[model samples]
Target chain A: MATSIRGRGGIGPALPLLTPAYLWLVVAIFLPLSAMALFSFMTELPMSGRDWSLTLEHYAAFFSSGLYVTLLWASIRLGLEVTLWCAIIGFPAAYVLARVLKGRAREAIFLLVILPFWSNGLVRIFSWAMVLREGGLLDTTLNAILPFRIDIDLMYSYPAVIIGLVHSYVPYMVLTCYLTLQAIDNALIEAARSLGASRLQTLRRVVLPLAMPGLLAGSVLIFVPVVGSFMEPRILGGRTGTFYGTVIEDQFVAVFNWPLGAALSFILLAVVLVILSLSAPILRRVQ
Target chain B: MTNLLGKLAAQAVLLSVCTVSVHAAELHVLNWKGYGADEPWAVEAFEKATGHKVVNDFFNSEQEMLTKLRTNPGLYDVVMINAAFTGQALAESLIQPIDTAKIPNYADISGEKANSPMLNQDGKVYGVPWVWGLTAIAVNDKSFETSPTSISVMWDEAHKGRVVIRDDAVEAIQFGAIASGQNINDIKDMDAVKEKLTSLMPQIRTFWSSENDWNQMVASNQIDIGTYWSGSADRAKTQFNLPVSLVIPEEGAVAWLDAFSIPVGSDNVEGAEAFINYMIDPEFYVEWVTKVGAPVSANEKAVAALPEDAFNRAVMGDPKVADRIQFQAPITDEQRKEYLAIWQELKVGAQ
Candidate 1:
């Protein structure tokens, strides 16, 4: 359809069709981002007749404070950990769904894989709280079945935060990997195995390399949001929940420092762009 | 055809009578969810009596409330603001001075609360005192051999890894200030406050930001003792049946009052005042306190009317405890940043 349209009007005819999407991007993405950038340099929000002036102090504050840098590092580490766990847990599930499962069973299991997305995020986080808290379902069930009592309290800890995030994001990894894994020709795997290659070797040499794009896509999908996540950490990590995202949230909501919040957010955006650019080479090579 | 015309005439007459009797105006109220203003029965009663429908919008934080007031001028007729923020609202002219004459129940409000400087600017009232409560310690009865009386119990080595506090910078700083015997409104030494809070790092199991979080931690037996709101403690005990006890420490507790204010560009001032009046009415207060847990009503008459066994009365009745209450004062923007900086540092240090 695009070629036919271009054959008639040399792209001018498509401008009307494309304008809406581009306009939407400019309005929804660029406009608010530009506004945030402008606010980041402001002394205060120019509203309600409050005195305001342009200033670099918010960015200066971010640079001067070691605490923000440390928290940003912590957040990055959290993102990496959560992404790694998601890949580890999700890849096997995706493999089963794509290679092992067949017919109605695959569809049903796929439905179940995406089931967490159907429920409210807060409700899901709270449900995890019930299961992870001390003397909670996990603890009582373990103690009830085991010969000896063992405590299994994991709530409000770093592990709990990781578990919650991994639970929330693992589906993205599964969905992405399943799509790519399904597209790979099974004949290649069979041929590798029919030759001298063993099953592990077939998987590592044939299947894994084929699935790299999906894995990278899944990693990017999971990593970006986890780094900025506040609710999961606040609800699950508790005392250890404070992160770069939560601090920025505090500046806006608790501290009423929007200029600083904007600055922090803009910095996070820059960091994410840098990381994405750094990873682009690897993604291109894998593809 | 004759019967249809007769029915249409009858319907028209009824509609006219209804319109004449009811002067209904929708009042948009801003408050914390589940707080007094949004009580279903009370709103129903107010609507029935005054023929004005109440629509409630909630904010999770005081800053969000201020933002709503600032951004959406003429949208909200009535807003519930903490007294500490009332001065800021007045300064920004986000809220207009409430005429006490419009709310007859204003006379029944306790003079101390009504005359609080936080609600007044240039001798004009910007907010009408509504409800008040404390940020103090709550103890799990099962974990304690005896009641703990001092705020220092938070730092007690025995309860290490089982204590929690709200995850708010200002509240945490004020808590530290109180523990260090510095006035909440005026802390001279920042380092001392930082030291006191840093010392508390070992004792904290987690930090709770909401009533639900606090209740869940206590219910699951995750926390033994922590800083909690007085009103929430009442709910945990009476409603949820959690074995929690509220303790006012010897070092005193932080108190905050929520007040009803008219936004500057309110389209329905009469309706707003009527809603505020109904909120402070003794009858409404009695039902709200009995059916649902709440901060103590600012109206002395409402407090007096509570049953002797009412949870609020049992917890807040003592005049001696009142003497030790340190009402939260207005904090400057700079002060908030400093407190948040110290708090962020402390949280980072904990990790």
Candidate 2:
């Protein structure tokens, strides 16, 4: 259709069709981002009756306070830890679904793996709170069958945050890895095996390298959002949940510091872009 | 037959147009859920009698409300602002002073509740006190032998890892200020306040931001004692069947009053005042106040109308409850920034 349309009018005819979508993107995405950037430089919101002035103080405030840097580092570490766990857990499950599992069982299990995506993320995180709190499902159930009692107070702890985040994001990893793994030809694996490559050797040399793109894609998907997430950490980490994202959340809703929040958000955006650019070489290899 | 049907349709449309013209005013109310007497019957009756439509929008917190009010001027006719922050709203010109002439029921407000510092700012009335409650301690009866006598119990080593403090930056820092025996409204010593707040970090099982989180934590036995709102504790005990008892510790507790304020650029000033008047109507306000578990009815008639036992349970009945309460005062901007900074440091240090 594109070729026929081009043959008719050298792309001018298609411009009208594409303008609406591009215009929407520019209006919806670009305009708000630009406004946020502008707001970050302002001393006060114009809506507040205060006389406004452009200043670098909002950005400078980040550097002046060591606390913001520490929180940002903490959020980065959280994203890394969560992405690592997702990869570790999801890659194996994806491997099983793509290779070891077969037919109706595989399909049913695949659906089960992705089921978390269908429910409300907030409600799902809340449900994890129910299961992880002390004397909750995990503790009571373990005590019910076991010979001895054990206490489990995972809620409001670091592990609880990790568990909640991994549960929320692992599906992306599994879905991505499965898509890549399924596309791998069976004959190539057979040839590797016939050539006397051990199962572990074939997996390490062929499977992993072949699957790197999906893993990288999944990592980026999980890492970016997790770094900016406040809700999960607030609900699950409790006392331990103060990260860059939560602080930014506080600045807007709790502190009523819009300029500072915008500055922090813009900084996060820059960091994400840099990270993406750094990973672009490997992402290119995946294609 | 077609001409007759057409004539009937025209008459029906004319009747609807006449009805629409009668109810020409709309008051956009921005408040927390159930801030007003929003019962269907009360709303319907109010609409019918006043010929004004009340459209309500909700926000979760004071800061959230301020953000919305600032960003969208003229979007709201009336707003429910925490009494403490009414000054902030006025300073920012987000709200305008109330004309008591427009709200004749203003006379119905009790003198003391009317004199609440939050309702009047810079010698002008910017807000009308609506719902007021105590910020006190909620103790699990199963854990405490007797009612915990003091706020010091919150920092007692025995209760470490079993106490839930509010996640609010200002409140958390103020708790520390109070712990250090500093006047909560006047904290001149920042370093000392920070040290005092950091000292309590170890005792916090978690810092809860939402009432639901606090409720679940207390009711599920995850927290033994907590810095909780009076209404929340009451519901946990009565509704959730939790073994929780409310107390105002010896060190005093933070109390808050949420009030109605007209936004700066309200489109329907008369309609807004009418709605505010309707909110304090003894019959409607009583049910509304009871439903929300708010302890105080700012209206004198509503207070008189409450059952004797009900009034006793309400914070208003306990005369000493007022003596024990330190109403939250609007903090200076510098203090606000310092409080958040210190709270952040405490949070990070605790981890």
Candidate 3:
């Protein structure tokens, strides 16, 4: 298949076809990243005739202060927790959709899975606040059904942040896992059953390994953004929301220290890259 | 064919001339979204009276505002700047000094506000005083038996896990400084301020960033008390129907004044000045304050024109309250960094 396509032009026709996408990547992604990298080494923004010189102080500031490193670890932990929650909640839903449900019902449930993407993210977060705050929907409903009074004030706490993030990102896990799970042959599962494997063992040894790529893909998609999210934590985490992303946000909008913000941003990018590289080996094996 | 071409040429010439005239009469304004400058009626009135159209752009924060002015020079004719940042704008030459004599309404501006050091340097007025407001303590009326008068209520153990404050480094540090009896602008004892802020952390339920956040938290009964803007507090009470009371604590409230200035390289300087004159006029101020809950107007006559029980007049009109008000001073970049560092450390420690 590769030789048939290439035999016509010997990479000549493909160059023009691929140029626009590569150009876009260079213009949209690389240029800004390169600018940010340069900016991360500056004393001040090289605008408005302000006297500025090349400096390593901004990078040094990050290392000298323990606050940034601590917050970065906190954000990483938040990313991991949210990713795990998303996997737990989404995998089963995907399984039911891919295996148990039939044509029209499967389509309806699939639509429901992706429904959260239709609305604005901010609106969804605020809706959770409505449900999570004291005297909110969750609290009112619980108290009404039960004989005794109970409080369910989860707003502005760490758990609330995690819940909001997981709610926002679970759709990615569902979509990715559903595709892979649906591709697993019924014959293979039947063969496992005929070989005297239990339902749990069949899922553990056969189904899980087959769905690894999709699970890993979904985890990566959810993990990266969750690590750098400022708005979700700010709205739901309350005082506890001061993670690495929020601190970087302050450096730009609140503190007007763009150089330092760029430095911090570059550091975050490097850390994310390292994480991705570490997972590349496992991802390659699954593929 | 010649006649048909002649008619087309004539129409094209007339269209180009009209376009040039309309473009010359347009003024680009930079301000906060929905803050008096872009009010539909006010814009209509200004355009009708001056024969110049107004176009507005918004910035969410003072830092973003500076960045816009810095990056997009000559794009904006007039800008609304907080007085605390006017000095920085002047130092960077982002905004040119206004010719107050060109603005007819400049005479009616209150002497204290017009001559404020933040807006003036070396006897030249850089920013024309427009409006002012207070960052004071606001409490859910049901939570307090009697109106709390001191800022200490934020640190009161009874309100622990029910108290909130703005998540701003400058405001938080200044609030802490005031609570610790240090000057808001010049804090000689950083250790004391840090101690006071660190102690207040446990009492904080969450930090509110935007006015919407404050209203949602307060309305839902998640927070009983917190630091809030006086103008927003008024709106929360009157518009949102929230039972919020704005308090001028014994230690005085943090005050901020917003001003209008012409940016450097503005093509329509005359139109910008006229627009600013309209903005500060008693007619505009009175209509804006009465119709939309607004910050205190810089025009004294505008304040007097309000009904006796008007929110701004009732709360900020008193001379005693005015005397105690600690208007925000220009924050140096170094000082800002230091304050932010302290604020970040405090938040991290709390977490």
Sorted on lDDT, best first, the list reads 3, 1, 2
Per-residue lDDT tens digits for candidate 2, residues B1-351, read 999999999999999997876555877888877445555777788999988887878898877898889889988998988888888888788899888777877898878778877678677889987767777788988788888878888878988899988988888877777677777898778788788777778888889877777777766877778888876776566456778888887778787777889999887888889988887777776675465455566777777887777742454467776776777888776677777877888898888
Off by over 4 Å in 1: A1-9, B1-24, B309-311
lDDT of 2 at B125: 88
Per-residue lDDT of A144 in model 3: 96
Each model's lDDT: 0.91, 0.83, 0.91
| TM-score of predicted structure 3 | 0.95
Give the runs in model 2 whose Cα sits over 4 Å from its true position.
A1-20, A279-287, B1-18, B21-25, B40-51, B101-104, B116-118, B121-124, B265-267, B289-292, B309-319
Q: Is candidate 1 or candidate 2 better by DockQ?
A: 1
Q: What is the DockQ of candidate 3?
A: 0.79
Against the true chain A, what TM-score does chain A of candidate 1 give? 0.95
Predicted structure 1: lDDT: 0.91
lDDT of 3 by residue, A115-203 (tens): 99998999999999899998999999999999998888998899999999999999999999999999999999999999999999999
> Clashes per prediction?
0, 0, 0
What TM-score fits each model?
Answer: 0.94, 0.91, 0.95
Question: What does candidate 1's lDDT look like per residue over A1-287, in tens digits?
Answer: 87898689798877898899999999999999899899999998988888899999999998897999999999999999999999999999999999999999999999999999999999999899899987889998999999997888898889999999999999999999999999999899889988989989988989999999999999999999999988898888877888999889988889889899999998988998899999898789877
Off by over 4 Å in 3: A6-10, A279-287, B1-18
Residues B1-351, model 1: lDDT tens digits:
999999999999999988755534878999999887887899899999988878899999998898889899999999999999988888888899888998999999999899998898787999999999999999999899899999998899988899998899999999998999999999998789999999999899998888888887778777889999988888788678898999999899999999999998888899999999999999998888777767799998999899887767765968888889899999998888988899989998997
Against the native complex, each candidate's DockQ, computed on alpha carbons, is 0.80, 0.65, 0.79
TM-score of chain B of each: 0.94, 0.88, 0.94
